[model samples]
Target: MDEKKIAVIGAGIMGISALRRLSENKRFLLTCFERNYDLGGLWVYTDQTENDVYGRKINSAMYSNLQTNLPKQLMQLEGFPMDEKCPSFPTHTDVLAYIRKVADQCDIRKYIKFNTEVQLVTPVSENTQDTKWLVTYGDNRKKNDSQVEVFDAVIVCNGNCSIPNYPMIDNEKEFGGLVIHSIRYRRPELFAGLNVAVLGASHSGMDICHDVSKHAKKVYLCHRGSKLPTFLPANVTEKTSGFKRFTSSSIILDDNDIIQIDAVIYCTGFKYDFSFLPEGILEVGQNGVVCNLYKYILPRQYSTIFFMGLMRLYILFFPYGDHEASYIKAMLEGSVDIPAYKERIEVIDDDSKRPWLYNSHWEWDKELAGIAGNFEPFQSALKKIRDHVLEVKAKDFSKFRLDAFKITGSDSFEIL
Candidate 1:
């Protein structure tokens, strides 16, 4: 078989993993494009929330003083454990360092084109088996100097967190206070001495509420979810009723009560931005849900194009990337049999909103690893430990970060 020229869209966690695994196969000629000068993607922190040094709007949502939501054990890629001295939930800097170490050790940086942003990706031909992609990319600083290159396959690892999902709130513009998304949020000191309302109670919402509560005069955690941390900060108030409208100096709840607040920080999460890809190929719908993916990895229309790191697999993203990269390698090498177009499309559950495999994520990873023929199944202890961590977090969100656990066996762990 001829060398299969492939173009990877990013140099983030999943991009690095894909480069490492795919490059291992002698039949592949790989080139990875990274817009930023360095790797680490969103894990790379910046104080400038709006724009980068190149004048491009910053897409990374990493903030100062942020720590991993999951323990380090669940964050490691295959065959590479995080630093032993690192805390259970290491800081953002520590995670970035670990990602760099993995890329360096794997020698994947040689294929990277840094400071180059991908502008567009389009199919050169409709023939799935021999399909080629026209990838247009150029220096991040230059606008009209895009260069096009043809590749046998295109792997999208640009990630979903780059685009902030701002939901519509009635009369939101009328709100006199400052409004910002979690992506723009950095230091808690920004909210010092002010009453802030945090919308959404997910991991980011909860963490931001906790951080701001220490400096802000008060924080109102507004969410519709029922399961929330029981032990919230003293200054933090939980509001189950959703936001109805925004007033000039306050917000009106669904029950018609008004709460005075100085500012609002939206923790409503992110959306998928595939502007580079042609329309009709991939459609992003309500709540940022994308459909027509066979397993959230491959698009129903093309076999040569693959989407990596798109699943909402919580803390298992690193392992999931490894499995996906390996599986892609097998599929390209003709070692794994792919289902027909109709069969693939028929198996996908369009009703499922989110791209993630919630409860079946581990099983899905196992299935991918098995198909890859070179990877091992996930450790049984991982799922158990993850479940335990989730349980602890629900009871006391603050305690989960401080608590550590050591894996004792395939299905057990000892608290440290």
Candidate 2:
């Protein structure tokens, strides 16, 4: 058996899982490229938001006080539990430490190239079964110092939250207030004593709004969603209408209410950035959804190319990556047959939503685990914990994280 050379991009959670799974068989020669000095990806929080000393855009979206929205039990990778002494909803530092521990236990650091960035990845031959990939990368600081390497396969585990998606407002240019994306947001002190308008009602949007409310004079939690959490801070007011436009010192809501605000924080999520890959290799939709993927992991035309952790999940990301890594391992090791290109295209075309896996992770995890051969079934307790967390959050938006939980059985959990 010939050793297959594989390039895994980004030593984040997804990349670590891929490296761990693929390195199991000695036949795979894995080389992982990470731009940072260490693993942990987005969990690696830095006070510097815009650019590092090397003039690179900071990749972490972690805020100073951010804790795991999902509990540690649900966030654990298979057979790798977080520290028992740590709280269920551990802080970002705790999560990063856990990620480091996983990598150390798996001995995945040997395959990783720290301080290296993958500049581009292109298929050597478009239509061949044995098509190779050209991975061009170099020192993250030295733009001109690039080198190319050929590999039998490529895995893209670079995260999605790095590049922020800022929605255009009608008169945003005329606004005098400061405007920034949630990706650049780091602390609540920045909004102290000022009336702020937080745009978006998604997880980050709601969380940021709540965070800012602590220091801000007033926070308008603006969103398009009809259902707003009733348990908002006294200073945070729910605004269900969309943003009509922005004035110099105020914002016009869809309801024609003009409210004075000192700043606008867009928690409008992020764009899926695969700018390094050539156009035809993968197709991202205009609305920011990945369209060229078959199962949110495999590209329709390139069986050797896998994109891990592309879907938005309500479940913990570790298990999601674990399931994906298992499937990719099976495909790379010749344990499972890769689907025909035509079949893959048909499956993608029939589904309107290609990679939005929110609320459907259980079935998806089971399907991937089953395909990966002998693996334990997706645990029922995880789903229970997730649902319990959601219920707790819905009932008490600001105080849910204060509660801790312990899994008691395969389908039960006890709150502490």
Candidate 3:
């Protein structure tokens, strides 16, 4: 096959990893677009800046105690084992360093265009030509700021975290203290000495509550439903009982009948902003994702453009985004056959008001594993992942692991 030109939007963890895999094939001429100057997207550290949408300054990247929710062993890429000196669950900075190193070591940096945002992507002719996409990007440095590029295939690596989705709370505007979404969350210092109410019970919500409780007079970790346990076991000790969870759809009013809250941080999670794509090409679901695709990859109607990190789930206790990227890359390179879209798009709970496709981290992992034809029993899955990590460590970090008092961070490798 002729060397194909592929454009990847967003130079984040998933994008960098996908680019690395794509670089291995001499037949792939890849160009990565990032709106930021640096390689890391949300992971990169940045100072507080005024957010036009929220009308407030926020720490776009850094939080005082940000750490990976997954263990380092599972989180690291297949080849690069985490440094023995690194903590069990690596810090955000450590993850950032790892991503930066991968980009440099794999020589993907040369193919990337920083400070470039993808404005629009259109299918020139639906599945008619092998090269299916005419992608347009806006160059931030240019005055008029527009450029066009064609790609045989386009990987939508721009992840779900960029767009914030706030639930419709009754009288939200009328009874407000300080309402901010997770995107605007930087640090918890502003909530100090005050009553802070946090919404949602996801990983981000947990992190926010953990931080706010340290300084706030009283912190209320509020959620519409029962709190889901962290996928990974908690390691915090009894000395630090700073975080607490509460289930409440509405907050209690004050004596004066004012919906009193010093501040409310909605860590309810995010959705994809696919408005840039043509309506017929991709249908946005009520949950704010392209609904027609199976496993959140190939669209029901279009196969050329694939979504890499649309689903959030744990398969072998690893992030599903990276796995999705790997599968997409393989499919694009003709290494694997594209799976059936609708059959794989699992619909759970048809009785509910809104029927949602099951795209949780665990479900995504199993689906990808099944698609890859590397199916294993749950126990064997753990062992296989462990063996892979051990193999990488033996070749790459044998001396460090043996000499240092380091333990493998996770035992959930078999699920991958």
Candidate 4:
């Protein structure tokens, strides 16, 4: 059998987990590309604040004090559970170590080309069966002189959070306070004895506001949400209205209220960063969602290319990656046949009008899970996910992530 040449991009959790499934048999000749010196993707913590240098952008969004918001049990790769020593919510360092541990266990280090940044991925022809892609990358030694390789398929796991989404704070350059996104946020000591406004109430917004409130004299959590959590610290006051504009030292609320603040920290979240992909093939923008995807895995225009771990899920991420990887593997093996390419295009076209990006993850993931569930390991993980997400959502995010669990068997665990 001619081994299928598969290229896995980015050595993050999704990239590595996908590698585990893709390299299941000798039938695959897999190659993994990572720009970093090592793996762990976003989990690898770097102190640098500037996300972009020259042309490339830093992919990792991990903060120094950040811990896994979800329990370790929920975050485990289906077959490979997190180490017993790891706590429920492991730290940034702990998550990186766990990824390395998975890599060592899977013996995938040999397949990866470290410090190699992928420059471009484009299709070769109009024929569907002739699924050849040109993957160009630059090695550390000679970065200017790049090289290209042909692969049967491409799995994009570079992550969506590499590009931080900071909407314009409409004003005539009046605001002069320090503006920092959550990605560059490390510690809160910089806001000591000062007034800080944390924008957006997303996960990062909530977490960053919590961190800043400890040091800032008064932390104003300015968000558009109707209600804010009451459990927030005394120093952190939630504002339901959004920003109208800002002055040199004061922030004007949408309701025409003004508050003096020393800094404006935007926990504004991120957008999908897929610059390596061909510009015309995919339409990913500042909207924070990837469009024209069939089942949210394969792009409708390019079925051979798959993007993993882009969906916003309430459940753990590792299992989602595992399921996606398994499905991609199955598709390559022809064991699972999705709808015809034409039919897929129609379905995506119709759904494109709706809020497909945010609302379609559950159904798409479920469908993929059902298809991949026919295989070993993934079957168990998928079975529990539907119930698990519902159960987890029923509880409070702060307290729920703290609950401990013990893995009793493969793809199975009991909440402790």
Candidate 5:
């Protein structure tokens, strides 16, 4: 059997896991491209805001004060364990060190091309049966210099947090405030004594509001009626409706009420974009809902192309990425079979019944990122983790940082 050449698109958490797993197989030759000189992806915090030191717009949303909302146990890669001495909700620096430790222990650093960026990945064949890709990449040191490599498989692990989705609001241009996306958010001190309205009330929004309240005069948490935290800082307030329009001095809500504020921080989430992919090969909307993806791994047209770290946004990313890598490995090694295209469509259709707004899929975006954790006993383990996470959260949202848990077995865990 001939060895397959594989191109890994990012050196983030998912890319690191891919390298750790894929390089173990002698049947695959790998090349990893990382735009940064290091790994850690979105978890890497930088004081440089809105862009890198080179002035390119910054994609990482990590704030200096950020701590892992998920426990250390949930965040670990399958075989890797975070130090038991570390806090359950360790600081961002701790997370980075753990990831680097995994990369070092697995010796996957040798497979990566640091300080390189992948510009494009295009199909070498227009035929549906052919699954070859030409990847064009360049080193950051040299401008206008690049090389194209032909590979039998391409794994895209560049995370989904880079692109900011500046929402379209009516009369937005009329506003005169320092409007910024969550990606540019570094600290809450910037909002000192100012009235700020936070858009999008998910994890990021909630966390940012909690942080900004310490500095801002007041924070109005804007959302479309999701569950609100029982505890918020004294300066924070919740608004149930969404922005209907925006004026230079104020914002109008769906109820025709208006509120004046100094600045607007859009914790409004991100758009998962893969513009480098050739047209018709992978069609994903702004919400990151992809079509023609069989189990969201191989696209219906190509078995050799796989996408990792693109599944459910709310789960533990490291383990899911590992699960995705392992599944693809089994498929490539001929131990698992790719299902029929029609079967793929049916499975995806059956899973799209999840009830939620598809902010990205727009309309077809209601599907859950469920297929990746389907492997048995592992799925059982994930369920236990979810329950444990919810239990700890419900117990004390304020003190979860002190809480800890250890996975005792594949299907079980014990609180530490």
Candidate 6:
């Protein structure tokens, strides 16, 4: 078969994983565009004393307490296994290294064009041939700035963290002290000696509150309700026998109706920023991007374009991105038939209302695992999902012990 050209935007974890999988196929001619000099997106470490949009200076590479909410075992790629030397909860640096190692081991770096940002992706199809896409990128290295590339297929793995959402509260303008989005958050020192109020109550919210409470005089973790999972899923252990849970020390609320806070950190989460695309090409949900097909693999009209890492939930038994990539590859290779669904995914009515409010991480794990077709006893389907998670986990664990450790230490591990 003639090599098919493919373009992937963002060299982050999801993008790199997609690229790695695509590279395995000899017929895929792949090119990846990343805006940063390095591969890791949010996982990459930077000095907090450095000037950011929050107008605060980051004094360190990364906050000391930063850790992945998911255990290392669940985060690994299909072939890579975690090394025995590392801890259960791997740090941000450890995850970054693991992703970088995947790029190296898979020989994906040669295909990646770093420090290049994709400005626009336009689909070109008319009365003639098969559909193709024209990808336009901004060249950070060249003075000309405009660079153009085209591909047979485009995979958007940029992720949801690119754009941070700030709530427009009535008194938001009146409050004093520094207010910043979680994207700008690197450490808790900025909240030192001050009362801090945290909003959103997701994994990021929980993480920020946990970190700031250590240094801040007082920290108020405000939320509609806590939806975070207290443990890993039971199916993970029953299926793969590898999964762990990490618990938060404490999360307190304030009396003023708002969490008592001098500074407000909104770990409110992120959305798919596809504003660059034409309206007819894609549609986003109130809470996230809308998808009509099964597991969000196939779009209603755009069959050539696929979305990966759009789901923001516990991914214990199955790695959604890897599975999505596999399905896409099969479609490209003419193997698996794309499944259809009736209802399109919709966003939550109240953006502020936490849908995941009462649910635990373990619950999310079971739900996603079930949806990804991981629990099915069918050998082919089970093997695909199971092997994908295990490969990614093994590769991930080999680089970061914390990931594997989190699964081993979790209460779910004992139950499963």
lDDT of 1: 0.86
The clash count for each model shown is 0, 0, 9, 0, 3, 40
Using all chains and alpha carbons, the TM-scores for the candidates as numbered come to 0.95, 0.96, 0.75, 0.88, 0.89, 0.73
List clashing residue pairs in candidate 2. none
Q: In candidate 3, which residue pairs get closer than 3 Å at backbone N, Cα or C atoms, i.e. clash?
A: 312-361, 313-360, 313-361, 314-361, 314-362, 316-415, 316-416, 381-414, 382-414
**Cα deviation of 316 in candidate 4 (Å)?**
1.8
Per-candidate local distance difference test: 0.86, 0.85, 0.62, 0.76, 0.77, 0.59
Q: Compose the digit string of candidate 5's lDDT tens values, residues 1-416.
A: 58999999998898988888888898899999998878888878888876565545666889988998887776888778899888878888999999999999998888889878888898888546446999999886676869899999899998888888888889988999878889889988999999999998777887788888989998998888865645667888889889899989999988788989989989877777788887787667435576557666777667778898766546566776777787777777776667777787687666454554323322221123233232322344555666666665555455556656776776777767
The global Cα lDDT (0 to 1) of model 3 is 0.62
Candidates, ranked, lDDT: 1, 2, 5, 4, 3, 6
Better model by TM-score: candidate 2 vs candidate 5:
2
Task: Please write out the lDDT profile of model 4 over residues 1-416, one tens digit for every residue.
Answer: 46789999989989998888888877989999998888988888887777444444566778766876666766778667777888877898988998899899999999999889898887887546347899999875454969999998889988767778886777727777788878788888888999999889877787778777778999998888677534677788889878888788888898888899889888888777677776766666435566677766777666678888866665557877888888888888778876677887897777567665433555656666676664433335434643563355334434545566665665677767
Q: Candidate 2 residues 120-183, lDDT tens each? A: 8888997675589999999987768799999999999999988888888899999998899998
lDDT (tens digit, per residue) of candidate 1 on 1-416: 78999999999998998998898887899999999989999998989988777798898898897998888888888889998899998999999999999999988899999999899998897646447999999998876778999999989999889889887899999988999999999999999999999999987998999999989999999988674646999999899878899989999988787899999999999988788997877766555666667676787778899888866677577877888888888888888876678876776654354345456787777777776687887888988888888888889888888788898998888889
Task: Provide the lDDT at 268 for model 6.
Answer: 69
lDDT for 3 in candidate 6 is: 82
Model 4 residue 216 CA deviation (Å) reads 1.4
Question: Per-residue alpha-carbon lDDT of model 6 for 237-345, expressed as tens digits?
Answer: 1111111111132212332222334576776666567765556555565566454433444455566777777655454422545656665676676554444222322
Task: Mark the regions of model 6 whose C-alpha exceeds 4 Å error after superposition.
Answer: 48-64, 126-129, 141-144, 226-260, 338-416
RMSD of 4: 3.5
